[model samples]
Every structure is written in structure tokens, then in C-alpha cells.
Target: MIKRITAGLLAGTLVLALAACTATVPISPTDSSGLGSETIHVGIAYDSAGRGDLSFNDAAGAGLDRAKKELLVQATEATTEAENDQARAETLRGLAQGGSNPVIAVGFLYATAVGTVGKEFPDTLFAIIDDDSVSADNVVSLLFSEEQGSYLVGVAAARATRTNRVGFVGGVDVALIHKFEAGYTAGVRSVNPGITVDVRYLSKPPDFSGFGAPDKGTAAARQLISNGADVIYAAAGGSGSGVFEAVAAAPAKVWAIGVDSDQYASAPEAVKPHILTSMLKRVDNGVFQEIQAFAKGDREGGSKRYDLKVDGVGYATSNTALNRYKDDMEKARYRILSGAVKVPSK
Candidate 1:
């Protein structure tokens, strides 16, 4: 079942820091026939990883970049640090007040901030990724079935493990991330009830560094490896690189799985060989589609969901380790799609 929270962030007054402008890519319009004559100003308030994390934030950035190239758009991006939820409201407010019609907020952590600010800006449409609690008329919630995809990678980890033991590394201990852990555990059990799955979280609430700190991820991965986990799947955003590093440094041949985007295609050459697969969450497609709808004068006010049935989430098969299990994975995917298998969210 999908866990829903109704806590509103409109009660407290938030002090927002100035949005640090990291990068801005404005495309020159070459053709007037694209989309429309008026230029759409798109604004994004990014998560802690920002653009270079090669993970969640980068996926969001890819969507914005695509919109700028294909449509007549002037885009602006703002970066956020770990545990800076207060600043999210100001960032969105600034974008709307500065003429950005539809501002996008990345990450589920922005539920409170988006709820609070979205109510204030009823005219300017707001879209938030990974959150669904905000019910304002101007807010668009873009949610993904992370558990469904996480389950697929769990199967990969189970099939690829030689020690009959695997591990899961989560960025934080929250309801949103727990879905990943729950599905992974369920998938591992489905593969082999006798197999052991070791789970660890980098940090708890109020300490969001678990998603951004590579060293912590490396430490968690090493610990899991020491516990005889030969296959480790990480859903820790940018911190996932640390899991890759740990796998690379291990004396024994171990496998690692990535999240959000396909790490096999984006990881460094040295670590690429160790990545078994990735839980592909199509945040890029979701963001790009939402922008396209807005550009076409279609404003989304309700929640937009992306799942396996709709190709919003899946497992990456670019890695050699997972390539051999292609048929089995496809069968499992079909089972999930056909309702024969129900992946747990919590």
C-alpha cells in the first residue's frame, strides 16, 4: 500500500536562504515554429546532489536541458544543500515571483515546502517530483513507483550473488526510502527464501547527508561487504558512488546495483564493470513530459504517477552481469505488470 502523509507546512514561518545559482542554460531559438511564439520560463529547485551527482538531481537536470533544446524556453536552476527544507519555499517563491510560470521542486522532502508555497502562488503553477501530499490547486505531484523498480534490481542482486548473501544501502530512514528497502527485501526473498539480505542506512532523519556523502556510503558498503554480502544494491542517490568504490576496492569479485539512473552507463570505467544493474526511475521523462504539457498550455494541478505499467520505472540491463538474466527479468517484469506479483511499498 502507498503510504500517505497529510502534515501541512503552512503553520510555521520559514527563513529561506538565497538560492545559489549554479548553472543556467538558455537555448537560442532557431525556429519559430516550435511549440509557440511566447518563450516559457522554466525553473527548477534541485536537491542536494545538484547536477554532477550522476544520480537523482542529474536526472532532473537532463529533463530541463531537453526542454530547453526542443522547446522555446528560458530556464533557471537553483541548487540546495542537505537538510535545507526551509529554503525550498523561498526558492520556489523566488522562481514564481521572478516570472517562472511553472516552477519544479525535486525530491519528496519538498512536500511541506511545496504545500506551503504552492498555496501562496495560485496563479503560478508548481510541480514537485517524488511528492504527493501537497493538494493545492496549483501544485502538480510527480510520483514514481520506486518499489516496483527496486524489486527488479533485488532479483538481479539475488541472481548475481555467489555467496548467497546480498546487501541494501539506503540514503535515509524515511517512509519514502523505506519503500525501496521493503521491495528489495521482498524481491530477494522471492528469488530465494533461504538467501540472506543485509540492510543498512547511512543516516536517519534531520541528517540528510546520507544522500550526498560518498564517504558514508563507502563505509556502509564496506561494512556490508565485511558481513559477507557479495551483492550490494544502493538507493542512496549521489552516495551510491561510495558503494561502487567499495566494490572496486574489495579483493573478492562483488557486484553493485545503482538507483534513479543507470549507473552502468554513467559510472566511471573502473567501476562500470562492477555495476550489475540499476533501478531505473525515469525522473527525466517525468520532468520533460510535465514541461511539455505546460508548454502546450496544459497545466497539471493534480498528481501524476509513473509506474512499471506505464514505463516510468524499471531495471537497467546494460551491465554484463544482468544481461545473462534478461529472460528471467523480463518474465518477472511481465508477472508484475500482469498483476500476478504485487511489489510492496512499505
Candidate 2:
């Protein structure tokens, strides 16, 4: 249905808009004439909290950095603003028009924007991460079993909590965040149905600032902590920093479970001691694999799933507590991968 819009007309409208100022980070050098050459020019449009978030965007940035160094590819990166549909659309169009092939949009928010822009540049390949809504032939959807990974961390939270009460903090109250909450709650219940689970979302849609606001995360985490939650799992983006900060400042021994990347390695050293484990979503692997596929003259379209069975989703084992619970987590991982245990993604 997105194809109903005239591609030529949309392209014309975006030509002048490309010069508008926006928050962007250039990852690599530019090569204008490398359209069909061996050189792969990647353009990434990141979600809120851009690079250095040490969470989701940073994971994607790691992949691009690897491709630039090892694959010798050129890349340009742009970031989107909070709840700005026009900015998201213009950013994607700007990347395509700038001669970057296989431009990647790095969040579910880019679904509608990518669908609209990919049509204008039929020759340019486009990919979207965490979104499967766009079904264009030129669009490659990079999906992850985030629920599966969240489930693992939930188990860790339930097992490590001294007080049988754990909490969950989400960046936004959307269907995607719901998947994290559902899987986490299910995993916690699977461990001990009697365990109390408290859940809270930072903000609703259209107020995406929740993903970037550490102070808001701190407030939410404190409330959960006061309510007797000894362990907290945060699926918030950069806002997870607030959760970690709160845990670090708590007088009691509070533990935190991070999402997306390994918070133990990515988080600040002061907060590292408070992080019990992390839910590994493997956004870096997905980005690298898609770019590698494009470079091999392969146009892999449709919804590509990254799940636990393929090492796409898993848990970080950097914390010392993992030594005690390694066997249990491994067994849980096997059961889920084998389909013996079904994790809800609601």
C-alpha cells in the first residue's frame, strides 16, 4: 500500500530538504562514485540517544565500526529526534539521495519512513532494525528475539534477588516494549510464580524522550526500589543509565539487569558492581550480517529473525553471581531454544 505514493514526486520533494540541519555522526569517509563497486557505503539513521548511549545505539555503532575497519566500507550516520516523523523521513531520504546503498534505519520508529523512502530510490537497498512492518522489496528487516533475551535476564533477576521482589523499567509504552515486559514477567513467574514483579514504563509514544532521559529512569527505579524490589531489569535505551545510577546510590545491595548489550562492559565502572547480568540482544551481529550480505551481491529481504537458537539472543555472564547460576540459566536457554518452554512476546 505504501507503493501507492508516486516515487518520483517524493524524491523531488526530498532533494531540497536534504540540506536541513540534524543531529548526525559520520562513521566513515564518503565515496560518491562507489555505487555498484566493491566498496559498500552504509548510511545509518539511528534512534534517539544516538552514539555513546552505551546501550542500543552504541551496539549498532560497534557493528558499523567493525565494517569500516575490516570490510573497509564507508558509512554516514544520522540520529532522529523525539517523536518527529518528518525528521525521521527526511533523514532516511537524505541518506538515500547521498548515494549510500543499502541505507539502514536503526529502529522500529523508522518503519513507515523507510517504506516511504525506499520507494523513491528503487535502486538503493534499505534495511530497518527492530521493525518488520515495512515489506518493500528493497527493504531488509533486521529483527531480534528480544523477548527471548529478556526472559533470560528475568530469570537472573528472580534468582539473584534477596527479597523475592523484582522490577522492570521500559523506555516507552509501545507494543515493542510490551514484548520485553511480557517475556520478562513470564520468565520471572516461570522461576517462582510467587515472586512479586513490579513493572513501569518511562513514557508513552510521541514522548520518546523517555529513551534518553536518565533522570526519569532514576525516579522510576527509586520508586520500584522503595516498593521492595531488590533486583531491577531495565529495557530502557540510554535511560537505563538512570536505573544503574539509582542502583549504585542505593544503601542496600541492589542488583540491576541491563538490556541490548552487556551493561557490565558498556556501563560506567562505578555502576559495574551493581549490574548482575545483561540481556544480550545482539544488534551488532544483525547489523554486520546485513551489511555483509549486501556486500556479497545478495539482496536478502523479508523478515530475518535473530533468536537464541542461532546465538542471536542470549545473556551476559560477566558478573560473579553467574558462576552460581550458570547451570540453571543454561538449562533455561536449552528449554526455550528446544521449544519446550514458550516465552510470551505480547
Candidate 3:
């Protein structure tokens, strides 16, 4: 069950903060492409760092962009910098009230907010990413098998590491991020039971600033590197940038693995060579599919899982450095897909 936000916590200060921090972008509606005559107005409520994070939020934005072009839908987006539930609830309410159907909330943090605002607007459809706790007829949960993808990256890291040591830097110490850690550790140990795997989280729950803070990511990566970790995987959202920076600056050749999007493609030239690969979460595909389903007149709400078999989650190959591990990664992928390997999500 989803936890309900306390009614008394909706303070005036939160309202003011929401107003000051929320920025909504409105896209002009165009003719619906073959779906129907009705213009589908989609709205997205992003987590912290919003569109420019070049990681999670950008992946969602890519889906919105596809909807705009392929589906010919008008879109509006609002981002919430505040960590509290009140601000997130208001952002969703604003979008739904403005006639945006199938409002997409970019992160699992919006679960409670979606539950609250979803009740108020029964007619409006709400799609939330990374969470499946909201039990509402009007809500659709977009989830991914992050562990499956993380496992593949872990295999790559273990195989590429010369020091037989690797590290994982998570943004927050939450169950969601724990899945990444669990799968990574299992993958490392699977390759070599004696391999040392260092793990660190930037922040804990109720203080999600870790996802947006690059400095903490740098500190964590530096600490792991000092301990002789040659390959590090960062599931730290915007903080992953710092991890890349830290790896690139190391005196010895070190590899960095990114999460969510293809970090190697977006990384700077100096950092590109250091990025081994990224665990592609395919959030963009989830978002696009949700909107596409609604546009096709399927309004039923339920949980949709994007896993390896569906090509929903996997690792990137943009960096040629991953060539040596291609055969091994493919074998691992086949095993996971064929049910020969069970990746843990804890």
C-alpha cells in the first residue's frame, strides 16, 4: 500500500516554494496522427534536476519528444525541485487540472502524490515511472527490471577490471537503488567469488539531494578509487557526472559505468574514453509506450514491467572499449532471458 501524505503537512511555505520552483512548458497542439481527431495533451511532472540531468529525466523527455513527433500530441511539462509530497502533488494537480491527459510523473518519488492527485481527478490518467505502489484505477505504473541490466554491467565491470576490484555509487540508499547494488554485487561475485566489490551511497531516504549532487558522487568515487577499484558503476542520476569526472582524472586507466541513458554518448570527450558502458534502463521506451497505449484508446490502468526479454533494460555498446566483453555479455544476456540466471532485486 502507498503511504498517505499527512494533511497537516501542507504548509503555506511549501505552496510558496512550489510556486517559485515549478516551471511548466506548454507545447502547441498539432493534429493527431491517425489515432483520432482529439488532440492528446500529455503532461510530465519530472523529479529533481528535471530535463537537463542527461540521465533519468532526459530519458523521459525523449519519450515526450517522440510523442510530439510520431503521435502528434501537444505536451506540457512541470518539474518539482522540492522533495516534499505537497509540492509534488500540486505539480500533478496543476497538469491534470489544465486538461493534460495521461500525466507522467518521472520518478517513483511521486507515488504518494499520484495517489493523492489521482483520487481528485478520476477522469485524468496518471502514469508513474519506477513505482508500482499506487492502487488506483486511473494510474498506470511504469516499472523496469533494473537489476537485470545492472547485472550485465557488473559482468562487464568485473571482466574489464585489472585490479579485480569494482565499485558501485548509488544516489540514495533506497530499495530501488538497492536493486542496482544487489544485482551488481551478484554479477561481480559470479565472475570471481574473491573479487572485491566496494559499495557506497551518497545519501539516504527523506533527503534525495544525493540524486542531484555531483560533489558527493565525486567524493564517493574518489574514496572507492583510492581503495583500488578500477571499474565503477554509478546509478546516481546527475551525480553520475562526477563519477565520470573522477574516473577520467585517475592516474591509471579506470572505467565508469552509467545508468538510465547512454552516458557515453552524452559525456564530454575527455570523459568518453573512461566510460565503459551504461545500464540502459529504457525509461524513454516506457513513457512512449504508455502514451502510445492511451492514444490508441486503451485507458486501462495497471502495472507494466519492462524487462530484458522485451528489450526494455540492458547495457550500452557505444564505447568500443566494451568490444572484448561482447561475447561474454551476450552469453549472460541469453542466460538471463532463458531463465538460466535469476538476478536478485534486493
Q: Which candidate achieves the best TM-score against the true structure?
A: 3
How displaced is residue 153 in candidate 2, in Å? 1.2
Worst 10 residues of 2 by lDDT: 14-23
- Native-referenced Cα lDDT, model 1: 0.82
lDDT of 2 by residue, 1-346 (tens): 0112234523433222121122223333363322234556778888867887888898898888777765667777777654566767877877777677888888998888888888899888899998888877898888888898888778777788889999999999999888888888888888899999998889997778788999999999999999999999999999999999999999899999998889998777899999999888898999888887787677756878999977888889888877787777788888897899999999
- What's the residue-level lDDT of 318 in candidate 3? 98
Q: What's the CA RMSD for each of the models?
A: 6.8, 6.9, 6.0
**True-structure lDDT of candidate 2:** 0.81
* Overall local distance difference test of candidate 3: 0.86
Candidate 3: regions farther than 4 A off: 1-34
Per-residue lDDT of candidate 3, residues 147-223 (tens digit): 99999999998899999999999999999999999999888878888889999999998889889999999999999
The number of residue pairs in model 3 that clash at the backbone is: 0
**Model 2 lDDT, residue 312, Cα:** 87
Off by over 4 Å in 1: 1-34
